[model samples]
Target: MTSQTTLIVASPSAAGRHYECRRHVTCAMDDAWWKSSRHRMSQVIKCRFLPPARRKRLAAAGTEYWKSQARKYCDFCKCWLADNKISVSFHENGKRHKENVKKHISQLSKRSAKEFKQKEKLDDEMKKMEKAAMAAYLKDIQNNADLTSQELNDILSNGEGSSKLVLVPAPEKVPVWHEVKSESGNYYWNTETNETTWDCPEVYLSLAEQEEQKLKKQENEKAKERLKQEQQKDVYKEVNARLAREKMKEKAVKQPELIKNKSTYTSTFGPAERATKPYGSWTPVVNKPQEKVDLQLPKSSKEPIPVPVVYEPETPRIEFNEKKVESLGEGPVEFKKRKFNNHIKRNMRQKTDDD
Candidate 1:
């Protein structure tokens, strides 16, 4: 059973046709009315009708579908408005919206100017780099051309010289004989003959070898002269050090004698007495003995003297006898209670009064 019921007629009657025509007209009118109502509601500026400005939308399947999703959002004002002529016009004309739009435009202009400057700077740098690279490339090409031309000139000169029978001396061959020393002993190497032997080669010495030997002999002589000079320097330094030590000893010995000769203390005699004995001589003076005056001592009385006794006070001492005190156990005594924190109580009282 379908939820929708359909009327059936046995024949094609006028009444059936007229009923069909009336139903079609009613459906069309209802559809048109619904469309008009939806459009009118969308135009109304209601809180629920506005979408959030920062709403996240899922990516659509195609670019076209995504592009079609143009929500009524103001980028500058940072809010969603009704997508209608009246709401859009009113929001755009508001003071806050116009200020925000002006700020955005100013920022964009500043950013574009900064970007343009940076691009110009980059272009200048790139141009400089290109010019430097071209200069280097041309310089390298010129250097290569000069080298090639020199090589061609040398080849031409050689060709011209080959036409004449010029007496050219053959190149001097280098001696390949070398002496190798190892733990087993010295060995001689004749590289030209590819021979190695313990004994020295009997072949005549080449000019290079003779020159090398001469250089070695001169170097050895110079080294010997340096060693002799160094030994002489050491001897001279030792002699100088010994002389310095002897001079210092002599000074030390003479210093004590000089100090003994110089008197550091002042004379006790006055200037007149010193002038009288200016020859650094002083005579001992003897004085005559004076007559002694005799005085009689006061005689004590024969009566018995009475002695007076003096009294002295003693200090009182405090003694803490351990036997008299009670024993103190490991833990605190029960009588020893913690003292009250009066400072915290005072602070709390002050805070409470302030509050």
Candidate 2:
């Protein structure tokens, strides 16, 4: 079927169209609705567009005279007579034809009403088109060549009516609000309430509105806090400035007073007591602050140590009964061993303090 081909005849008024048909196009066969000569004859005569004279000529389907009329006719309705057919006797007395006739009349009335509305719409559209064309023409004339205001006015008055050109004052544009959804879900500005509200029931709307207002209130609070901070800073600056001025005034007053009341002697106290302190002043030595020091130690402790002591003397002791030299015989004097001379010095200082 795909490889099979057919030729479709084209006309000057219509394009060539390919349609699926069981019979060949050249074969003298009828497969489509309203293609029969009788149906075509009947429909042509019934068409509302035909004149009475033409209807009468095409009404006689079997007659040779009826065959001379134009062959082309397009059927708007797709009714097939197989289910739609009726015996002449039944058709004359049938409920089907009666029902169809009533339906047709009803449909005709509805179509007439629709056509009237469409005609009004088309008339309005044509008027708008004319207005746009006139505007474009006037704009072109104004741009391409120079014309005086009077000439322009005269052209406007004569060329086309400007009273209607006042433009239906451009239909008052209504704000068309659209819904903006986010991760938080649906929300939009309500023009009537003049606030943002949620897409919910009347019961929840107030709660949603409260939430929204709460957010706005929080923002307002933050702004108020910032304003308060700025005011505080300004107040602090003003206070500091005032304090500095007061201190300067007090100092100025004191300067003059001090100058006027200056002492004949520069000393603020009696001469003996007014003497300056010496570089070194006395204080309990324990109370004075001490400097820090670092003392390095041996890296390792050598634990094994020997004691140092001298038990044996180099000279022999003299016996009491033994004969001695004349100087030594006077007395055997004993002497005490001292480790260091600084200890003796410390003892002497203590004695002096005691005295």
Candidate 3:
């Protein structure tokens, strides 16, 4: 059984006519089909910016979504979409995207309200602290006013009917206080209590305070006298120092002349034994006349001076025994020395019988 195959070519007239494939055109235009086609064609991009995915996603990946050449990103849905207007409109019209936008707005409002409450609470606490500080300051001012009134009463004293005598009780062994003035302020010292203060004491003219004031006046006078004495002593010290410096200058000037007058050579001492020391620790040198040695010549006959004869020891000789010597050729053999070669060739040695 043999099978036959046939090929048929279209005519020129049929080629000129265009043939079109037709589907159900009405079905393609239907809203349901369009929705299905849109859904099938469009890609669903998962948002890395979402709260659940943000921890695991890289910031660099999220940055790519907002790039000019990339797809469109929706701020409310926190997702990327196709860059076309149609895709954007479709996404915006969706129920899920609308709900996400509403939820985002609510979250923003809640966060703002929480921050405002926190700021208001902090302001209230600050106001309370400021009020407490102001109260303390006012109390201190009231105490200072009372002290001022008492001071005024003491300063304006009348004979017999004095307000100081009436208000202040009779003196009863109060602590002695001394006032010292300084550039910063005046400070008061209580000798008995050993306390110090910048403010004046309440009992200013007590018997003890009066005695201390008297002592302070005496001490100031004595201090003035001591200061005068110290100034005199300093003047004397400066004069003494100047006189000493002048004396040293004169001594230094005369030192070279004294050294020149001293003789360098002496008969009693050799030059080495009588070496001169430095000026700081110099010893006085005594001048002595040099002594001359008289040489007595042999009177008539000249006698030859005898020369001493000295003998030196000879060095010991070392000899080897003839019996200990073996054959002359038995010793280490001497090889001819060779000149050094600049290039040393290290090649693989040919295998020999020994190898």
Candidate 4:
């Protein structure tokens, strides 16, 4: 208990009146914390006073139990009938409801609406344009018919005046209709119809020039091949120049002018010769047997003494015993050492000296 938070709890008394019972509670929780949340409520319950009821009364006419539900209904939108704050606000803010409001406002006075006036003006203009276009179209057809009649009368007058002059002159002779043949068989033109016919000739000298055109195309193709070869040669030369530059770089790296060659860049061996090659051709030779020298030791008159057998000694066994080892006295192996009696002997000598 380390707080001073007071809470009101309603308790039913025998007098049939609910008392405003307040309790001074102490807790780690803050007094100003939210009273509706679960954590603060649990903390309030642990104070040992009678807890507030699980279901508390909100209000006599709260938002959930409002008798004036008509207040939530929008008067402007008659069909919009939501009975809560969130739904009513959403419906009022919605697009269809906003459009309905606009329509209602526009219908109040058509003359006040600029859009309606503009639409009426557009309709009137369209009708006037259609009528003008129809009248112009009818006038154009009448004018075209009158022009045709005038042209017909003029042609008749001109023909009457030039009839003798046009017929009296002798007609010039055209080249005789000769049948022409080529590698692609024979074909020709008709003089009477002035169209190409399989039976007659038309100079239009294209037949004679086809072979020359084919030869020219062949020459052009050969020229293109020669140009391509020249391009390939140029490319090869560029690649060779690049290779030479790379070789010069490698030579400079390998044999830098520490001892500058007064001679040329060419080595003693040709460019194709391997740098790691031997001076001459190697010959395969047979391996000769080696003669070993005999060791001549001095022989004595006495017989040679026999050597003695060298014995390999065995390591001693380290024994272990199950009995408890005494802290005093000597033991069998080197590891089992006894404690010295020097302290006891020194104490005895001190006692005897005191006596």
Candidate number with greatest TM-score: 1
Q: List RMSD in Å for every model shown.
A: 38.2, 41.4, 38.3, 43.7
- lDDT string for model 2 (190-303, tens) is 555544434443323344555776898899999999999898677556555655765887899999898888767555756565447766677665766799887886666777
Q: Which candidate, 2 or 3, has the higher TM-score?
A: 3
lDDT of each: 0.58, 0.51, 0.58, 0.55
TM-scores for every predicted model: 0.24, 0.19, 0.22, 0.20
The local lDDT score (0 to 100) that residue 25 gets in candidate 1 is 16
Instruction: After the best TM-score superposition of candidate 4, give how far the Cα of residue 312 lies from its true spot, in angstroms.
Output: 55
Assess candidate 1 and give its TM-score to the true structure.
Answer: 0.24
Residue 345 lDDT in candidate 3: 50
* Candidate 4 local lDDT, 1-355, one digit each (tens): 3655444333222211122223444666545544444443343332222211311332322311111123344556776464567887889899988988898887877656777899999788667655655554565567685765677789888886355644576774544343446444564534455343344334533455656657988999999999998986775565556557658877888785655655545556656756675687788999999998878978799998899999999999999879886786676655756787644764453545554
Model 2, TM vs. native = 0.19
| lDDT (10s digit) by residue, model 3, range 190-212 | 77765556567775454566778
Query: Residue 250 deviation, candidate 4, in Å?
Result: 1.2
lDDT comparison, 1 vs 3, better candidate: 3
Off by over 4 Å in 4: 1-185, 189-196, 199-205, 257-355
State the local distance difference test value for candidate 2: 0.51
Report the number of the highest-lDDT candidate. Answer: 3
Better of 1 and 3 by TM-score: 1
Put down candidate 1 lDDT per residue, 86-156, tens digits, no spaces: 88999999999999989999999999999999999979866765665565556557758686577778988
Estimate the overall C-alpha local distance difference test score of candidate 3: 0.58
